[model samples]
Target chain A: MSNKKVTGKVWKFGSDINTDLVIPNFAIYMTREEQPAHCFVANRPGWVDEVQPGDILIAGTNFGVGSGRPIGDVFVDLGVFAVVAESFNGLGLRNCVNAGLASLPCKGILDAFDEGDIAEVDWGTGEVRNLTKGTTLTGQALPPEIQSIVEEGGVMAKLKKEGFVS
Target chain B: MGMNAIEKILAKRSGQTVVKPGDVVMVDVDTAVSFDYGKPNIKKIHNPDMLVLLHDHVVPSPTLSAANGAKSLREFVAKFGIKNYFPVGRHGISHVLVAEEGLALPGNILVNGDSHTCSSGALNCLARGMGPSEMTYIICKGKTWYIVGPTTKIVLEGTLSEGVFPRDVIHYIAGQHGDFAGRNLEWYGPGLEAIGMDGRLTMATISAELSVEFSLFPYDKVLADYLDGRAKKPFEPSFPDDDAVYDQVITINLSEIEPQVVLPNKVAWNSKPISEVVGKHVDQAFIGSCANGRLSDFAIAAQVVKGKKVAEGTRFIITPGSQEVMRQAVKAGYVETLLEAGAVVTNSTCGACYGGHMGLLADGEVCITASTRNFKGRMGSAEAEIYMGSPATVAASAIAGVIADPRVALKVKELA
Candidate 1:
C-alpha cells in the first residue's frame, strides 16, 4: 500500500447520513459525470459547488445507510480523498472502497472537528489528525488485501493490471 | 472450535476444513447475479456458467439513459452467449428471481449487485451483496475475496400472535438490537417451524436494512420441499454444530411482538407500535418488493381487503415479486380480490421501491410501503414520508387512508 497522506477540509454530518442524501434519487439516471453536479442536491443544496477536490467528509454513525446505489462515485468523481465516520453501512463501505476512496471508521472523530476544520489522514497507518483542533486520533487500518486493492486504484484496476480481465 | 453455517460455507468454498472470523479467504462463488446497472462496468465475461443477468431495476426503461443501458446489456448478454438471462417481463426483482428459480442453492456462496441479495440466505445459502466492480471481477474470475465475519445467533422462541407477521419480528429485532453491521445473523430455534420459507425470506431480505451482510437459516424439510426439483443440483445441506461459537446471541420472543411500523427516513432503530402511527394520513400504499412481494404477502393483503373498498384519496398499488408469484396470485384469486378493492396491481419489477419508475411519490406525500427501505427520497421526493410495515398493515391502511392496524380493521370490516 502507498504511504500517501490525505489532507483536506472537513464536512461534518450527523448520524444516519443515507446514500440518498449523498446523491439524490433523481441523479441515479444521470451519467456518472453528470451525477457529481447533483451531489447532495436535496440535503445540502450547492454542496457540489462548495466542495473542492480532496476534501474530507466526517459523519456520525450509520453513514451511507441506504441502497447501494453507487453514490460513492459522486465522491470519487468530485475527487474526495478520504471519508471519516463513526461507522459505515456495509454495502456503502464496499462501494467507497470500490470507488478508490479511503474510508476510515474512527470512533468520536465527529466530536474532534467542526465543519471547515482542516484534517490530515494517513491511510497507511490509520493516523487521523485534526490540524485545526490540534488533536489526533487513530482510525482502523485497512486490511492488507483491501489496502492493496485501494492502492491499485480499486478492484477493477488491480484486476486489469494482473491480466485477470480484458 | 465448531464453526457456524457461514463459516462452514466459506470454508468449503475456499477448500479449507476450518475457518474463523476475520480470516480473509478467496471463495469460489456458486452463483453470481448482475443487473443492467452493472453492465457498464463489466468489460468482459470470463465465466458464463456461474453468472445470471437480469433486467429488473428499471424495467421497461424509465428514461433514455436506462433504455440505452438495457439495450447495451442485452447486446452484451447476446455477445457473450450468457445462458441464464432474464429480460424485462421474463423476471421480477433479481433477488426474488434468484430464490424462486433455485439459482442459489443450499450450502452455496452467492453474490449479487443489489444489497437485498441477502434474501437468498433463506435457502441456507451464504449470500451477500457486492459492489458493481466486485461483481464484475467475480464474473471474470469466478471468485472474490471476503473477510469471514463473526456470526450473531438470533434465537426466536414462542409463536407469533395474531396480526404479528414475520415483518414485525424483523422490525422488532432492528428496533431492539440495532443494525448487525458487518456480522452474519444466524436465525434458529422453534420459531422456524412457524415462519416457513416465505417468512424466512422476508426476514433475510430485510436483514440488509439492518446493515447485515448475510442472514442465514439452517436447512430443514420446509426448505427442501420448497427447493424440490428447483435446485441447480443436489447438494448436501449445512448447519452450525450444536457447540458452534457465536460472537453474540440475541433471543427474541416472537409472541411479544406487536404489529410494528418503521417510521419515516430510517429502517432500523426508529420503529414504533402501529397504534402510535395510526390516523396519520397516507396518500399511497404499496405492497411489494423482494421483502414482501411473495404470494403469501398477497394472500394476507387480500384477506384483509377482501370486500372493502380502497379510500378515494389514496392510491394502492400491488406488484408481485415474480411472474410465478403473479400467476399464483391470479390462480389463488388474490389478484381479483385486490382489484375488487380498487388496488392497481402491476407487473413484477423493483421500480416503485427504488423510485426508478411507477408509483413515485410527490412532495409532502406520505406512503406506507412493504418494501425494505424508508430512507429520505427512497420513493421519490425528499419531502415525502415513507412508513415501512407488513403487507397486512399496508392493505389495512390503504382502505383507511391512514396508518391503521390490520387486526382492528378486520374486526371493523367483520362488524360492517
Candidate 2:
C-alpha cells in the first residue's frame, strides 16, 4: 500500500446519493471533461462550478447507492481527492477503486465535520482526521491488492502497464 | 462447519473445497455479459466464446450517440467472433435475456456489467454485477476476483396466496429488513416449491435494490424442470451443506402476504400493503422490467384486464422483457388481449423503467409501475410520482384508473 496523505476541503452530503444524481444516463454520451459539469445536477446544481480542486466528499450510509456507473471518475474529474462515507455499496466501492479514487468507509463519519471544514486522510492506515473539528475516526483500510490498484492510478492504468489492453 | 449455497459455488469455481466470509479468490467466469454501454478498448480477449454481447439499453438508439455506440459494439462482436450476440431485434434487458437464454446455470459463476446482474442468481449460480472496469479485466483474463462477504439466510415458508407475487414478496422483504449493503442473501424453504423460475428471478432482481452482492435461490426440482431444455451448457447444481452456516436468518410466511406497493423514491423500508395506498390516482400503469417483465407477468396482466377497457385518461403501457418473451406472449394470446384492453404494447427493451425512451411520464403525473425502481426522476420528470407493484396490481389499476388492489379488481372482473 502506498503511504501518502491528503488534506482537502469537505463537502458534506446525505445518504442514498445514487448514480443518477452523480451523473445522469444522458451525460454518459458526453466527453470525459464535459461530464463533471453535470455531476449532482439533480440535487446540487452548479456544484461543479463551486467545488474547488482537492475537495473531499463526505456522506452518510449507502453512499453511491444506485447503478454502478463509475462515479469515482466523476469525483476525479471534479478534483475531489478522496471520499469518506459512513458506508458504501459493494459495487460502488469496487468502482471507486477501479477508477483510482481514494475512499474510506468510516462509521459516524456523518457527524465528524460540517461542510467546508478541512479533513486529512492517511491512505496507508485508513484514518480520517477532521482538522477543523480536531476529531479523528478509524476507517476500513483497503486490502493490499486494492491499494496497489489505487496507487497505480486505476485498474485500466495497471492493465495498460501490464499490456492487457491497448 | 459447512458451506452455504453461495459459498459452495464460489469455492468450487475458485478451485477450493471450502471458503468462508472474508476469503478472496480469483474465479473463472462461466459467462460475461455487456450491453450497448461498453466502450471496447481491448487489445485481446482471453475468451470470446464465453462472452455475451447484446444491445438493449438505449434500444432503437434514442440519440445519435447511442446509435453510434451500438454500431461500435456490432463491430466489436464480429471482430472477436462472439457467437452469443443479440442485436436490437432479438435484444432485451441483459438481466432478463441472460437467464432466459440459459447462459447462467447452477454452480456457475456469472458476471455482467449491470447492477441487476444479481437477477441470474435465481438459477442457483454465483451471479452478481461487476462494474465496467472489472468487466474489462475479465474480458482480458476471463477471470475476476471476489471477496466473500457474510451471507444472510432468508427462509420463505408456505405458499403465496392469490393476488400476491414475487414483486409483493420482495417489497415485503425490503419493507421489513431494509438494504443489505456489503452482504449476501440466499433464499430457500417450502416457498421455493410454490414459486416458479420467474418468481425466483423477480425476488433476486429486486434484491439489487437492497444492495446485496448476490441474491440466490437453492437448487431443487422447480429449477431443474425449468432448465431441462433451456440449459445451453452442461452444469451441476450447488447446494448448501446440511450444517451450513449463515450470518443471520429471517423467516417470512408467504401465505400471509397480500398485494403490496412500494412508495415513491427509495424502497428500503418504504412500502405498504395495498389497502393503505388505495385510490391514489395514477396516470400511467407500466408492466415491464427484468424484475417483473416475463411471459408470466403478461399472462397474469392480460387475465386481470381481459374484458375491461383501460380507464379514460389513464395510459397503460406494456414492454416485454425480451423478443423471445414477446413471441411467447403473443403465441399465448396475452398481447392481443392486452391490446384489446387498450394497453399500448411497445417493443421489448428497458424502456420507461429507466426512463430511457418510451412511455415517459409527464411532469406532475403519477405512475404505478411494475418495474424495478420508483425513485424520483427515474421514469421522467422529477415532479412525477412512481408507485411500484406487481403486474396484476398495475393492470388492475389500469382498469380502475387508480392504485387499487388486484384482489378487489379480480373479484370485480369475475362478477362481471
Candidate 3:
C-alpha cells in the first residue's frame, strides 16, 4: 500500500466493454497467459500487442457489464496499472478487486483525458488528475476493509494468509 | 424505517436489527453453486452440504479444457465431500438445476459463478451472480459481502395475452426502460399468479440482461405449490412489509403486451414487438438455454409445429436445459411432435446456446433464438445475426423459414 498513486499513459475505451470482449469464450479455454493476447480482439484486433505494461485505462459507464469472466485477470496479465470507469457493473467491480487490481469509478473521466494522455491517480487521496488536460476529478475508492483485502493481494491471498483457505 | 425484501434478508442474515441501502454487510449464503465453465480453485469448502457443483457449460466434453473442467469437479467432489454433484448426462444448467432440485428456497441467499443465477430470485431468494474469486471466498467462508442498493417496485396487472410469453415480457421491460444497473427489482401484482414458475423463472433470468442484480418474485401459493414435495430442505418465506420503502415504482399491464423480439446483438436499446420484425428470413431457429429450456418451452414449441414440416433449409435446434426437463418433455410426448416436424432435438447441455458446439451458426446466417443472449459473436460467427424471441415464435419461424407469429400457426392456445 506504500505506492498509492499510479501515473501512466491512458488507454481509453467506451461503455460496456464486457468480459466477453476482453477474453472471448474460445480464448478462455487457452491458458490465462495466452488469453490476454486475444484481449479486445473483437473491437481492436491485435490491440493486446500494443498495451504497454504500465498503461492505464479510462472507460465510460457500465464497463465490464456482461458475463462473470475474470476480466481483471486479463488486465492484470496485460500489466495494466489501473482502471478508471465512469461506472462499473457490480460483478465487474468485485472481479477486479478480487484479482487485486485497482479499479476506480470516476465520473466525468472522459473529459479529463483523451486516449494516450498521461494521468496520475492517487487512490489514497481519491484524486484523478489528467496531466495533459490540467484537470482533476474525484474517484470513488474502496472502503477501508475492502481496500485492506486489495492490499493483502486479493481475497484468496488474504484467506490463505489467515489460514481460512489452503 | 421499513425495509424492502432484500434489506430484510440482508439484515436477518447479517444479524442486524435493520439495514438500509448502501449498507455493506457480510451475509451468510444458503447455497453456493458453481458450474464447469469457470470452476473455482478452492482448497476447502466451509460446508460441503451447502455447495452445489455441476458440469453444464459443455457437457460430454466438446474440448480439452471443458473435459478437464468436468474432470476436475470429480476431484473437487471427493476432496470437499460434496454430495450434490451433477456430472455429464445427469446435469443441467446450474440455474435450472438449482430450481428443479428444490435447492432454491424462499428467504435464503444463493450465490453462483454464473451471471444468470439471479433467475432463482423467482423463488423469493436473495440470489445474485458473483465472480469466481468472490464465489471462492463464499465457498470457503460461507459468506459474502453485499452493498445493498435501493429497490424498484414493479407492479404487474391484467392477464398475459395469448402468444405472449415471459421472454417477451422481459424484452418489453428492457426495451422501455434501459438498464437497471446496481439496483434490485421486486415484482408483485394481480398478474403474478398466472405467470407460473416457468414463466417467472424466464422473466427473472432475462432480467439479468438489464444488469439488474436481483429480479425477485414474491413467495406466493404458486411457488409454495411448486415446492410442496420438491424442496431439498425446510424453508420459510419473506415478504416485504406493507410499509416498505422503494426508490421507484413501475407498473406494467400484462394484457397489453405483445410478443417482443430483440434484434440481433443487444436488449437494452434493441427490443421490438413481433410485428416490427416479421417476415425476416432465418437460416437457423434455436429453442433452449437456461432462460426458456424448460418443459413448458418444449410444449409450446411442439404445439406451434404440430403436424407441420420444418422450413426446407432452416435448421431447427432444441437443447433442453437439463436431464430432468428432457425426461419430463419426453414423457409428455412433446419431443416426438418436435422430432416428427424435422426439429433436431439435442441432449440437455448448454452447447449451442453458449456457442460451444452442437449447432453453431455459419457466417451470413440468421437465427431466431429463444435463448439467453443474442449478442454479436454470441452464437458462433461474429457476422451471424441472432434474433431472440419466445420459443413459440422461434418454432413458428423455423416452420415458415422466416420469423413468423405463433398466434397464426397455433390451432389452439395451450398454457404450460
Candidate 4:
C-alpha cells in the first residue's frame, strides 16, 4: 500500500459533535470545497479558514448523534482528511464510512493532539502519527469491506464499481 | 455455541448457518414503508407494488392549499400501484395503521424510512428504522445487511398494578437498561397477553430512544383472537424453540411497578412515584402519536375526561392515530367525551411528537405527553420540557392541571 500520508493542521472538539454543527443543511446546495468554510460555523465560527486540506478533526465520545442529513454531504464537499474521535453515534459512523470519509476511534484523543499541529493519517495501516508531538496513536483497524469502500471513494462509487449500475 | 433469540431469528431469515454477535448478513425485509413526504422519492423509483405510503403526519388541516397538497399526494398514490396507501382523512399513524390492518405479523422483519419503525415490533416483527437514503437503497435492492446482535429477554410477570400502563412498563425498562440498549428487548411470560395489541405497540414504539434493535411480544391467544375476525392472509409463524438460545433473560414482576414517568431530556430517565411532580402544572397535554394513539388508548383517556373539563390553563390535544381508530372513538362517544372535557380533538396526524407541525409549544412551556422522545427541541423549543407517561397518566395530568399519578387520580381498580 502507498504511504500517501495526509499532513495538515489539527482541530479539536468535545463529545456530541452533532451533524448540525459539522455540516448544516442550509449549506448543502453548495459544492464540497465551499462547505468546509462553513463547517462548524455554528459552534466554532471560523473553522473554515483555519483548516487546511489535510487537517485532522479530533472529537470526544458520542460524536455525531443528531439528525444524519448534514455530515456525509458536508464532509465530502469540504474534503476533510480524517475524523478521529473517542466514539461515534451509529448513524454518524455509518454515514461517514458510506461517504468514504476516514474515521478512527482512539482513546484519549483530547490529551493526545492539539490545535494546528500537523499530523499524518494513514488509512491502510490505521495509524495517526503526530509529527510535532513525536507520538503515534493507533486506532481500530478498518474492516476490509469498509476499507475497500474508502479506496473506491464512497458508497456511490463503490456501487458503480461493483456493477450495481452503469 | 448457541445464538440468542435475535441472532437465531435473523440467522434463520438470512439463510446463515450460525449468527454471532458481529456477523453481518443480508436479511429479507418483511414490511416496507413510504409516506406523503416520501412521495417524491417514490416517484423516482416508480415502483408502487412494494411500498406502504401513509399520509397521517401532514393532512394539511382545513386550508384549500393544504387540501390541494393532500390531493396531490393522493394522485401520486394512484399513479403508482401502491396497495397500501392510507390517504389523509382515511388513515391514522403508520404504526397504528400497520397493526389495525394486520400487516405486522409475528417474526417478520419490517423496514421503514421513518425512525419510529420499531413500533410495529408489537406484532413480534423485527423492525428497524432507516432513513430515505437507506430506504431508497432497500427499494432498489430487496434486502439489507445487518450485524446480528444478542437478545435481551425482558420478562415481566405478575399482574400490573393499578394505573401502570404499558408505556410505564417500557419507560421503566428503558430507564433500567439505559440508552444503547438497542441490542434487543423481548417481552414474554403470562403477562404478555394482558397488555393487548395497543399496549404492546406502546411498549415497542419507544424502544427507538433506547437504541433497541427491536421489541417483541411472543404470539399468543390474545393476538390470535384479535386476528381471527379480521381479514385473513398468509403469514409466516415463528418462535424460539424450547432449546432456542438467549443471551440473558431478565424477569420483572409487575406487582411492584407503580405508575412511572420519564423525566425531561431522555425517554429512559424513568422516575419513581409520579407524585413527585404533582404540582408541576403543564401548559399542554398531548395524548396521541404512533406511541399511544389507538382506540384503546383513547378509551382510557376518556375515562379521565368523562365529566371534568381540562385544567383552565392547559391545552389538551387528542389525536387517535388512524382513520379507523377515530371512527371507533367517535362511535364509542369517547371523542364527544374529550370535547366536553375542553380537549381539542385534532386530525389523525403526527403532531407534537416533533416540532415539525401542529401543536407546537411556546418557549419555557412544559408538556406532559404520551408521545415518544422528550429530547430537547424534540417537540418544540429546547426550553420546553416534556414528560412521557401512559395515556392514563396524561389524561389524569390534564384533568389535575399538573403532573399526576393516574393511580391516585382515578383510583384505578386492582389488576385481576
Candidate 5:
C-alpha cells in the first residue's frame, strides 16, 4: 500500500447520501471526462465549480446507498482524493475501490469534522487527522488486497500490470 | 464441515473440495452480463462464449448521448465476435431478460455489472454484481477472485394474505431489519412453496435495496419448473448441507404481513402500514422495473384498472420487464385493459425507474412506484417524494389519484 499522506478540504454530508445524489442516471450517458461537471448537481448546485482536485468527501452512515451506477468514475475524473464515511453501501464501496478512489470507513467521524475543514488521511496507518480542528480519528483500514488495488491505481491497472488484460 | 449453497457453487467452479467465508478463490464464470453503460468500458474478452451483452438501460435511445453509448456497445459486440448480444427491441431489463433467456442456472456463478443482478439468485445461483473495473477483469481473464461471505438463513413460514405480494414481504424485511448490508442471505422454508419463481424473483430483485451482497433461494420444484425448457445446460441441483452453520437466522411469519409501503428518501428505514399512507395524493404511478416488471405485476395492475380510468391529474405508466413479458401480457388481454384505462404502455426498458426516461416526475410531485428504490432524486426532482409499493397498490393509487389499498380496489372490481 502507498505510505503517502493525502490532504484535502472536507465536504461533509448527512446520513443516507445515495448514489443518485452523487451522479444521477441522466448524466450517466456522458463520457467519463464530461460527467464530473454534473456531480452532486441535484443536491448541491455549483458543487463542481467549487470542488478542486484532491478534495475529500466525508458523510454519515449508509453513504452511497443506491443503484450500483459507476458514480466512482466521476470521482476519479474529478480527482477526488478519498471518501471518509461512518459506513458505506457494499456495491458503492466496490465501485469506489475499482475507480481508484480511497474509501475510509470510520465510526463517528462525521461528528469530528465540518464542511471545508482541512483533513489529512494516511492510508497505511489508518489515521484521519482533522488538520483544521487539531484532532484525529482512527478509521478502519481496508484489507490488504483492496488497499493494494487502490494503491496501484485501480483494478484495471493492476490487472494490466499482471498481464491479465491488454 | 458442512457447506451452504454458495460455498458449494464456488467450490465446484473453482475445482476445490471445500470453501468457506473469507476464502479468496478464483472461479470460472458461468455467465457474465454487461449493459449499455458497462459494455463501453470492456476492452477485451477472455471468453466470448461466456459474455451476454444486453441493451435495455436507455432503450430506443432516449438522447443523443445514450444513442452514442448504444452504438459503442454494438461496435464492441461486433469486434469481440460475441454471439450472445441482444439489441434494443429484442432486449428488456438485463436482470429480467437474463433469467428469461436461461443465462443463469442453478449452481452457476453469475456476475453482472448491475446491482440488481442478485435477482437471478432466486434460481439457486450464486449471482452478484461487480464494479466496472472488476467486470472488465472478468471479461479479460474469464475468472475473478471472491471473498466468500458468511451466509444468513432466513426462513419464511405460513402463507401470504391476499393482495399482499412478495414485494410486501421484502418491504417488511427491510423495515424490520435496517439493511442486510454486507451480508449474504439464503431463503428457505414452507413459504417458498407458497411463493413461486415469480415471487422469489421479486424478493431477490430488491436484495440490492437492502445492500445484500447476494440473496438466494433453495433449489426446489418451483425453480425446476421455471427452468424446464429455458436452461442452457442440464445441471444438478445444489443445496446447503443439513448441518450447515449460518452466521444468523431470521424467521418471519408471512401470514402476519400486510400490504406495505416504504416512504420517501430511505428505501429501507421508513415503513408504514398501507392504511396510514392511503389517500395520500400521488401525481404519478409507475409499475415497472427489474424488480416488479413481469407478467404477474401487469396482470395484477390490469385487474385493478380493468374498468376504471386513470385519475384526471395523474400520469400512469406501465412498462413490461421484457419483450417476451410484453407479448405475453398482450396475448392475455392485460395490455388492452391497461391501455383502455388511459395508462401509457411503453416498450420493455428500465424506463422511469431511474429517471432515465418515459415518465420523469416534475418538481414537488409525489409518485407511487413498484420499482426498487426511492432515494432522493431517484425518479426525478429531489424535492419530489416517492412511495414504494406493489403493482396492485400502484395501479389502485393511479385510479384513485392517491395511495389506495389494493384489496379494497379488488373487492370493488369483484362487486362490479
Candidate 6:
C-alpha cells in the first residue's frame, strides 16, 4: 500500500442516495470536475461548497443504484476523501474502486458519529475510525485483488503501475 | 472441456491465455462511451476518439433544469475537443443511435456508461454497460477484467404467430427463464434468420433485464444483408467454433407460445394469461425505452391503437427510445395514430423509465410498461405498481384499459 491515510470530516446522509441523484441524469455528459459541482445538487443544495477536501460522505443502503453513471467520480473530483455507506449497489461499488476513492461499508459508523466530526480511513485495512468520536467501526475489508487496485490509486493507475498498458 | 460461444469470443478478442465460464479476465474493449454524466472524468482521462457522448435523458424534457444541464454539457464537449458528442435534441437514445448509425460492428466488444448499453448487442456484438470510473479506467488503460460467462444456447424456432413479435418472445423467455436463470442466452438455429434486425434488437436488449452477463447471435446472412445496405463495407459472419459446448441450452418454439405478458415484479410467470387480466383497471400505459422503443415497436403500437382510444381512467404515454426512431416513426405515420388514439408522444429520451422527468405514476396507480426495470419507485411513486411487456402488449393494454394480451388485437389489426 501507499501508506496514505485518508482523513476527512464526516458528512452524513440518509438511505439510498442513488447514482442518478448523486450526479443527476442531466449532468452525466460533463467532465469529472464539472459534474461534481452538481453533486447532490437536487437533494442537499449547496453540497459542493460545503464539501471540503478530505471530507467523507456517509450514507445508508442501496447507495448508487440507478444508471451507475460515474457519480462516484464526482465525489473524488470534489475532493471527498472517502465514502462510507451501509450497503451499495453493484455498479456503484465498481465505480468507487475505479475512481480511486476509498469507499467502505461500515453501517454502524453512521450511528456512532455525527456530521462535521473528523474520520480517518485506512484504505489498506478497511478500518474507518472516527477521530472526533474516538471509535472504530469494523467491516469486511476489500479483498486482496480489489485492494491491489486501490493501492495503485484506482484501476487505470493500477493497470499502468503494473505495466499492463501505457 | 470446450468453451462456450461467449468464452471463445471474449478469449479471442482479449488475446487471453485462458478463457472459461465465470472466469474474470481483463480484456481490451473495442468501444468505450460516456456522456454529460461522464464529463468530469472525460477531462481526467483526456481521450475522446474512443468515446461517444449522448444527451437523451434530461435534455428537451419537461424540466428546464434538465434542458439547461444538457446545454452546459454541449459547451463542455466543445471545450474538451471530443468529436463524438451528440448534442441536445440531436442524437437519440445512446443505444439506438449506436445501432442505427452503424457504430456497432460484428465481433467487437462494446462498453458504455449506461446500464442498458447491452442494447448494442443486437448487432451481434458483445456489448455491456459500465460506470464512469470503469469507463475512465478502460480509456486510460484500454482494458478491464470481464467475468467471461459460459454460454447458454437459446434457440427461438418457428415463425411468429400473428401479433406475436420480438417483445413477446422476450416476455416469454423472461417468463420461462426468469432473470439470471441462464448464464448466457444466444439466439441460434434457422429461426434466427426469420426475425428482422429491429425485432432482433428488441430481444437482445432485454438480456440485461434478465441479468445475464451476455447475449449474442451468430452473424448470419440476415445481419450481413442488413449492414450491407446501410454501410458500404463487405461483412463476414462470426459464430462459435463447431467444437464449442454450451454450459446450458434452452429451446423455445415461438409457435407454442401464445402472445404473452410478464406480470408485475417478475419476468417469468405464465400461470395466468392475458385473458385473465382483460377487465383489470390500469392507471397508466407506457410504450418506449431501449428495450422496446424502436421504429418497429412504434409501428406495432400504432397498428394496435388505430381508430381506438385508450380506456377511460388510463393514461397512455409513448417516448421513442431515440431521435432517429422518433423521426422515422413520425414519417411512418405511427405518431399521428398514437395522438389520434389519445396517447401522448414524448421525445426520444429515457423520460418515464428513469423516473425523473416524464410520465411519472402517482401513488396506488398501476402501469404497464415497455421499458426495462419494474423495481420500486423506478418510474416515480414508490407505491405504484408496474408490469413490463412488449410494445404490442403495452399498446393493447392501453386500448383495453388493462393488461390485455396482444394476440386478438394483433390479428384484428392485421385484418383491418
Per-prediction DockQ scores? 0.58, 0.65, 0.57, 0.20, 0.55, 0.17
Evaluate model 1 with DockQ and give the value. Answer: 0.58
Which model scores highest in DockQ? 2
lDDT string for model 1 (B16-131, tens) is 99999888888899898988753644556667878888888777786787788898888878767888898877878888998888888889988998889999999998888887
- Per-residue lDDT of B206-263 in model 6, one digit per residue for the tens? 7666656667877778787777756423333347767778777888787776666666
What's the ranking of the predictions by DockQ, best on top?
A: 2, 1, 3, 5, 4, 6
lDDT of 2: 0.87
What digit string (tens of lDDT, one per residue) describes model 4 on residues B1-416? 65544665688789987777656677877567866554343323424555677776566543454455566667766766668787656777878887788777766777776657778777767777764455655665666666555677778788898778888877777667564432667778877757788888887888776666666667678777766655235665456666666677878888777777888765544555576667788999998888988888899999877778899899999888888989999999999999999998987887667654678778899999998667555676656788887899999989889987887666643321
Lowest-sum lDDT 10-residue window in model 3 chain B: B407-416
In candidate 2, which residue ranges exceed 4 Å CA deviation? none
Residue B304 C-alpha lDDT in model 5:
95
The CAPRI class of candidate 4 is incorrect
State each model's TM-score restricted to chain B: 0.97, 0.97, 0.97, 0.92, 0.97, 0.92
Q: Residue B382 deviation, candidate 6, in Å? A: 0.4
lDDT of 2 by residue, B1-416 (tens): 99998888888889998999988877889899989954568888889989999987789888888888898899889888999999889898898998888888898888888888899989997888877788898888888777788999999899888789988999998899888888899998888788998989999999988888889898799988989899998998888899999999999999999988999878778899999999989899999989878999999999999988999989999999999999999999999999999999988888789888778888899999998888767887777889999999999999989998999878777788
Give the winner by TM-score: 2 or 5. Answer: 2
Off by over 4 Å in 3: A1-3, A163-166, B37-41, B411-416
lDDT of 4 at B151: 73
* Error in Å for residue B18 of model 3: 1.4
Better by DockQ, candidate 4 or 2: 2
Q: In each prediction, how many residue pairs overlap at the backbone (N, C-alpha, C within less than 3 A)?
A: 0, 0, 0, 8, 0, 17
Off by over 4 Å in 4: A1-71, A74-143, A146-166, B38-48, B61-80, B229-232, B269-273, B412-416
lDDT of 5 by residue, B1-416 (tens): 89988788888999999998877667998889998753555555788888999888788887787787888888888888889899887889988998899888888888998788899989888888887778887888888766677888999999988789999999998888877666789999998797877789999999888878789898888898899999988776679998787999999999999899999988767887798889999999999999988999999999999988999999999999999999999999999999999999999988799888778888999999999889778888878899999999999999999999999999887788
- Candidates in descending TM-score order: 2, 1, 3, 5, 4, 6
Name the lDDT value of residue A121 in candidate 6.
81
lDDT of 6 by residue, A1-166 (tens): 4474688788999765666557654465555667877777656779889888888888875566546567667787888878888765556667787778777766686687799898888766778888997888775465566656656677757655555445
